[model samples]
Target chain A: MVSKELKVTTEAGIHARPAAAVVETCSRFQSRISFIKGDIRANAKSIMNIMLLAAEYGADILVEAEGPDEAEALGAVERLFAEKFRQE
Target chain B: MDGSSPRKVLRGIPVSSGIAIGPAYLFHPQKREISRHPVAPENVEQEVARLKRALERARKDIQGIRDRIAGAVGEYEARIFDSHVLILRDEEIMGTIYSDIRENLNNAEYAFYRRMNQISDRFDQAAGGFLKEHLIDLRDVASRVIDILTLSDGGKDAPEIHHPVVLLARTVTPSELAQFTTGNTLGICLETGGKTSHVAILARSLEIPAVSGIPWKELSLEPGQMVIVDGNAGQVILNPSLRDIKEHEGRRAAHWAHEQDLAGLRDIEPVTSDGKYISLAANVELPLEVESVLRHGADGVGLYRSEFLFLGREDMPSEEEQYQAYRHLAHHLAPRHVTIRTLDAGGDKPVPALQVDDERDPMGWRSIRVSLRNPAIFKVQLRAILRASAAGNVRLMFPMISNLQEFREAKRLTEQAREELRAQGLPFDENLEIGCMIEVPSAVLMAKEIAREADFFSIGTNDLAQFTLAVDRSNERVSDLYEPHSPAVLRQIQMVVEAARSQGIPVGVCGEMAADPYLALLFIGMGVDELSMSPGGLLEMKRMTRAISYEDARRSAREALRLGTATEIHQWLEDKFRDLFVRLGLRRGTGAG
Candidate 1:
């Protein structure tokens, strides 16, 4: 398993579009990806699960991936978080 | 709780005015007529394959809606569809649904529905805000898949509406609403929307009773159940009781009688009792509205919104196509003045053919700014207006002119179009009067400069209020802040009136404010030359104009100017006009009445 802690930098953190982008990116790999925000842990590939986390701006979330491509999946998710989900 | 018994009532924003009681037609565009059946044990693989194919079809459907919404609105609004596509493709949902169908020996439809319900319940149990809203996206994707899986014959064509119905929907596009009008659509109730939305405007124009902003999903509504839509009061009653029907019927009859009373004043001139004549005109959008303008005994067609020709179309209207539309109105309302506004596109009414990418401030890259930048399009419209002028008494007007420079530029383009027509020896009205719409705060301050180059002035108080107060009128959050009766907004109208008077030109008001009886009297009192509104408002405004003395209106206007806030102004006007309104049998909060 590969894990990395990242902060939501977008003004509207984990909004519909960002959450959607996160799910789209995480679902691409053959790995089980999860996002942990404090006590709430959500499957990164499920939009509803990610959105339920309600991770606001400047909040930290720990991204973990487990499978054959765990390392690749974690790297991609970290890059997406750093890019703020590419929202305008 | 009984199927045949009366249900609860819902409240919403009263967008259009009327009263309608009819059967409820739950209009779910993505709703499917699917049935559940236990699958044979041997055909389990077939059902799973069916589910996979349906998912693929659902994903394609979402992509189509995404592309269409992107084309019509923009990329930002279209992003919501991206999430819907992902939900359809989600392995967690697909894997669970497929397994349920195989193991439980259930039909694909039941499997998919059960899984969707489970996921949506999770969404509902989660924190509100973003998570709660995701339920809609989830349902949207599920519905698409269900629709594809259960695709059957004869389930199409506007839901088999056999009787007149109060159509209920989450949200309706203008084109969808247009389809329902062909049927026996009695009224419209939306789960979401504001008064300024396109659907709402179309409803008002069609004279349909409409109530928006209802949480319709929370309500349990069955197709063909009785429903009551009280647009004036913004109430929607599901499965209305007999008593409710009787009560609404009584109110409807009373409202009809009041309308008849107003219609009686249609023939009477809009001159105050003290003999100050106020020209009452109609603001027309579609050419079909010309009949209503004439029927209501309007003096002429004021503020002809030419944007209607360009809206909801794939390409820009050709010069000849526009000329024919304007000419039709001019000829029909011949001898009476037709102040046709130039292409007021780019704002809320964006022309797809123009390909204007700037959606930042739709109000910003709109109106005269759009025309001035794309002079070729502007000149085409101006030339059409000039050509239409040859058909009848057509006057040209420009909208959203913020300063003298924009007005001069618009006027210069008109002259260029005129010169082209003159050189071509095309018969056109050479002496057509030109006007400017004072709708911006800057225009109010520079009214004198703009009035110099213009032959007349028309204050569009809707945009004027929005610009003066820096409030987006369409935004429900700050819609109350967009007050036309506010002291600041009223003072601007007063300034424009004064500015026009100094230039020896006539001024009129062609906005929602002009249709308002209280503000109509105030504008008449403030020496406004004309007032233009919907045909429904013409006779009522005419009745009010004849009832009050010019001196009384002038005094009231003077008093209103001293008020500090919109609430104060509203209170004063209510105090002054409520008695008169009551006497006229105009019901409270009923714009139709």
Candidate 2:
């Protein structure tokens, strides 16, 4: 299992577009990925769950992945956050 | 009450003039009813499978829509569907739904509905409603799945009308109305909208009887119940008595007989008794109207509202699509001039591709302004019209041109289109006539300057009267102030005619005012060279033209301009023409009158 804490750096935060990006990226790996925001845990592959978290700009989210490809899944999620979901 | 259902009469605003009696087809596609029933314990697996099938179908539906949006609009607008597909594929949500049906023995629809409601409630309370917009996407997906589960033949939005029926709805979009053009829709009744609405205009153009503004709750009708739409009187009769039907049938016969009588004047030239010839033309929206225009024997199409091609669709039409439509009209009506108006979108007629900002002022950022700002889109249409010019006698016109600069900008882009076509080795008319609509007050004021640079003018009196009087005709409070017979509006028309005459160019009135016999007489007297109206009004206007001498019409119109108020002018013209109109069967007489 691997876990990493990342901050949402986009101005609009994790809205529909970014949430979609997270789900699309997380679905590519054979790992169980989930995002933890405060007390709520959201499945990274479900856009509805990620949107329900409503992680605003500057909010910290912990991504936890568990599987044989956990390290690769965590790296991909971390890269999405660093790139602000490629939204510019 | 004589061995028939009790009669109930409802009054509304009459938009299209006709009478139709048929079964009622109540259309409320959005307000679908979902009833919950328990699933048998043995059938639990089958119910779960059904849920999965619906979700898969919905996912495919969203995918198709996403592709179409990406093709028609852009990638940015299509990205929202990506999230929708994710929501449809969310196993966490589907697992809960699957367990609900298995554990609680609930039907697939109820199980899915309950789970969606819980998710919706969570979305409502999340981040103080920051995710409310996402909630709409969630509901959109949920409805698609639910509609598929409920409807047997998949989920088609438009209802199929195999027999003659009067369509009743809350409000109908232009696209929704177009689907009913199969001729099975005998009439239309709406809970809202007025005479000038796009739907009303379409209904009138298609010759369908329509009455609007009837409250939906008051229309308590059963499926296929007998109803009467008396569009001439703006009344709807539900469960109409046998006697009432008989009376309306009589009136319908008389109306058809009157129409047949006017059909004899189709080929006659619209020359006044004083030897002055006037051109009569038709204002068409769809290419389908070309056949009607020809049947009515119009000299040509004076106002082809091209914006309608953009309506009822999500994506902007490609240049090829527009070129095909324009070429169809030009090719079919060869030698007869076909004037295609550029996109006049915004303010009442909203195009999704344009994405106009929601402005409180309807006149702001609409019409030519929208076209000027979006040159890429404007140029595509210009190129299409230019390409079609080679097929026949095609003319291009711009709408709502406020000044010479705007007209000049439009003309420059048209020239650019022409140059591009020429460079591509394409053929088009070198001397294609270009015109500008004299609709706005400022355009009327600058008519002389605009005329010098343009080939012709067409007066759009609906907007002219609305703008000149500062009345929003759609607003009920000020609609009464929107008087086309007002002295101010009449003088503006005269000014545009004078400007066109000075420049040695022809001018025409292509608005609703031109369809009125009295107003047509006034326009002829003012020396307007042409009059354009709906196809249905052509033969009648031609009859009126052939009955009067231009010298007499000119003198009456001159006398009318001197009148003080709109009422005085209207009353004076009515008195002078009332006898003539009654003699010509244009007006109903009360025997004593």
Candidate 3:
């Protein structure tokens, strides 16, 4: 598993809508994805779970991915955070 | 209100749905596009001259916005244009275009276009379709430079106001809309916005009746077209005939006269001609709306839709932030009851983080369901409302409680909130009345059960009709099916009324349904103890109530319920109250008490 913390830059953070965007992109790869904020962990794919995180703008949360193409997933997720999780 | 001669008739989709008469100010006039054809040697000098001319024009246009922003709002909001100005002045980008390919001025622009198109590609990465359309923003700046050099503003002067004015535009900037003077502006019209844009808020702040989002795209727009924009109707008639102008003149006059009549009612009770005393509360969306609420004779605020605060904001408001806002609202309307509905995001209003497992079935999970799922967040809201309650007569309500189970569970959470406040020793009205909106069919059916435990029931007719009819109000195809006056909807409301009345519970309405002056008599007669509506609708409703005896309203309700369809009920009301229909035009909703 590759894991690291990245701060959310989007005005609304990695809430349900942005999380879905992230999930939609992540799901394309053969990788398992989950987001962790402190001890609270939730599936990146689940909108409800992501919103429950309440990751406001600039809230840093740990992103982790496992399975095949994990490196690719890690790179993509990092780039997304770098861009502030705003959907194109 | 000038240039009374009918100019040209124009048509577009009505978003605000109203009519008014005034001189037209056609903003965002169409521009003649310069072709992107390859330049031959003979025309190269002319092309270079055109490029220089456009640049000069764009600079002045940008400067006008800068000057206005510097004057009215502040520098911060205008910074978007400032960034655009920076793009125009980008040294490296401009230098690359002019220096890399050609020494000739016209050739320089050709090369610059190639360079900037690359930058445009980069700028479009925000992934906002709306922002992408802002490719036009670049064109606007560029073209403005062209206009200044070519003197376009001279021909496109702001239409002279012969009478008091109602300015119309397609999404006016904060700088443009704010500094409007009473000498010319009666109100304003923005061709794009829905209830929440900053321009809308500021217009309301100015207390001028402004409407937004009339499809200006399809209108026969001219510089000096005689126009009447019913900000309420979102209707604009260009060069309205003499008869149409006189007709709207009567409506506008009566409207202003009615304002004077309602000002007297502001402090007085909403007692009918008889001894029956009823509550006249205002349904508010934003705290800023409280002014209109007070202006239109609302004794108290019955329904404060807190969801508005969340609109256009980034995320859930922190408890402290919520507390400050609630405190401000409650304090401003001191001694007046401000019943705040907790965050009830449903339909198309879900927070990205906040989702409905089933968007199709609103009853699937939104409003109270979302609140129930997030207890801690809800506690923050409850605490804010409770804390704010101490400042004045304040209460909290929940939305979408279809059964006694959810109501009780919500109340349990409320008690939990109370306990937390007690632990903190926060000054709060512990016995504040907790109410639930009666929208879902199940909620109406279980009103008695819900009523026994809750303080009151506020009928949300908008959602009540949608849920009962199983229709999406937003879907134009099914919009006709979403009728508030149908027998099924009436029956559901009657059950709620019966439940409220049987138990002597106070019931109020805070939906577009209650704001309808045509339905004013019916709602009051249906045993609704309070009517909450847009402040603008207050006097008209009051007048409507005064015209019809309670006896007539009850009779209409009974007759209306027996009708098969809303259309039939509408026909029935029109046939009976044809004069009232004429006065109200059986038209112009989305404006309120």
Candidate 4:
């Protein structure tokens, strides 16, 4: 399993755009990815799950991936955050 | 009560300003009721197959919306549907739904509804703001699935609309409102929502009268009952008395005659008795409207909305297709200058090619923003406009220009189109003037700076009022707050006129405000060079222009500017213009009450 903590960078938090980006990235890997918010673990591959997490700006969440492509999934997820969801 | 009995009138918030008399078309979305029926053990596999089929259909539906929205709006807006697709594809969700059908022996509809509630509950428990709003998404996906399941057997049919009528509904979503177009929806009366609602905005743009916040549920209206929606006064009268119908009909006839008499002055110049020349133009949406523009003796087409070509279609119009359309418009209106505003798509307008899903604020992605973001699309339109310029007296204008930088960027693209046409050895007008719409408050503030680049300025008062007042004109709750005659808005108009005058460029007012005779006078008095409105309004505006002197208009405008509030300005204008309007035979029972 590969795990990394990422911060929500956009002012809107993980809105529709970022959630779609996360789901789009996670779907590419053969991994069971989940995002861990306080007392809540959500399926990272599910846009609905991540949006439900509603990670606000500056909120930290742990992305955990289990499967063959765990490392790649974690890296891509981190990159998306670093890019601030590629939204203006 | 008998059918002929008149009930007390119900008042609502008027979103769009008009008077509509039509039958009531009660639109009640049929309830999708699916009761749980236990499946026999032997039929479990069949139930599973049924569930999979419904899910697949729901997925395709979402995909279709996504693709269409992506093509019309933009990728960001299309992403809103991506989550629905993901929710459909989520193994955890599907696994639970499938197992619930097998283990619990519940029907697929029940299993799906329960599963959706489970996810919606999680969202409800989550932190507020973005997360809380996501419950709607979860429900939306669930409903789509349910819709597919219930609709599989063709049990329910969409309401069959036979004629144009006043649509009465509890509430309507934006997507539902999009389907209401087809000329059958004469007006709208809703139980909920404010002027800023998408339905209200759509109604305004479509010119369909609408009112909201009415207790439509308590009205008990039949399908063909005569309903009068007075959007101007925010009243809906069910089963109006014979006297009531006669009174409104009489007023309607008088109003029509007044319009006819004004139209008779079409051949007369709009110059005042004191020799002040004021141009009366028409803002046309469709090419067919050119006939009326000429019939009304409009000086020119002040604001030609070119988006009509891009909208209500499936694909982006090619340069040739757009060129042909523009050529047709210029050919019909030859010799009269037509200011074709470049493709102002996006925002409230859903162009499948330019859709950007900013549900919270759509105004940001529309107009020049769409053109600036997609230069290829922008060039196609600019090239067409330039090509059409060669056919007749044509000028190009850009809408929703927010600042100098945006104007410069749009201008740079137009110049590129010009250079490309020049290289191709195309016959085009090289000296065709380029103008920008001063709609946004920022544009009004920076008008002096942006005016230096533009050949002229056309004030889009619809957007200017919304932006300056910080009110969504479509939201019924705040529709009353949208005041075009506000001192603040008038002052902004004054500032834009001053900016255009400073640069020796003409400025025109081309919004719904120009249709109002009193406002038209105020604008002319404030040094506005042109007044552009609907073709139906051109003749009346011209008559008002010729009847009033420029010096008197200037004084009235000055006095109006000194007013403290909107009501004051309106009352002052009415009290000031009442006698003149009566003398001119323009009073059609529409005098301010």
- Model 3 residue B338 CA deviation (Å) reads 0.9
Give the lDDT of residue B59 in candidate 2.
93
Question: What order do candidates take by TM-score, descending?
Answer: 2, 1, 4, 3
Task: Identify the candidate with maximal TM-score.
Answer: 2
Correct interface contacts retained, every candidate? 0.60, 0.81, 0.00, 0.62
Better of 2 and 3 by DockQ: 2
Instruction: Report the error of model 4 at residue B9, Å.
Output: 2.9
Tell me model 4's lDDT, rounded to 2 decimals.
Answer: 0.79
Model 4 deviation from native, Cα RMSD in Å: 7.7
Model 3, range B484-536, lDDT digits (tens) per residue? 77778878888998998887778988777786655666777787888886655
Tens digits of per-residue lDDT for model 1, A1-88: 8888998889877867898999989888999999998888888887767777888888899988999999999999988987879786
- The 10-residue segment with the lowest total lDDT in model 2 chain B: B584-593
lDDT by residue (tens digit), candidate 2, B1-593: 23354678999988877889998888753323344678889989988998899989899988988898788668888898999999989998899889989999988877887788788878878875678767767876886888788775333322346688898887877777877778898999998888767788778778788999899888787767889998888899998988999999998887778778988998899999989999999988888888889888899999999988888555789999999999999999999999999998877777766865224355786888999999999999999999999999999999998899999999999999989998999999999999999999999999999999999999998889988999988777878898878999999999999999999999999988898888899999999988998787788788888999999999998999999899999889888888888788772211211
TM-score of each: 0.73, 0.78, 0.62, 0.67
**Candidate 1 Cα outliers beyond 4 Å, as residue runs:** A1-88, B4-16, B27-128, B131-160, B169-176, B189-202, B211-221, B232-236, B264-277, B284-291, B304-396, B412-433, B466-488, B547-583, B586-593
Give the Cα error of residue B5 in candidate 4, in Å. 12
Q: Candidate 2 lDDT, tens digit per residue, A29-81?
A: 99999999999999999888899999999999999999989999999998898
Q: What is the lDDT of residue A86 in candidate 1?
A: 77
State residue B82's C-alpha deviation in candidate 3, in Å. Answer: 24
Off by over 4 Å in 2: A1-88, B1-6, B29-159, B357-360, B587-593
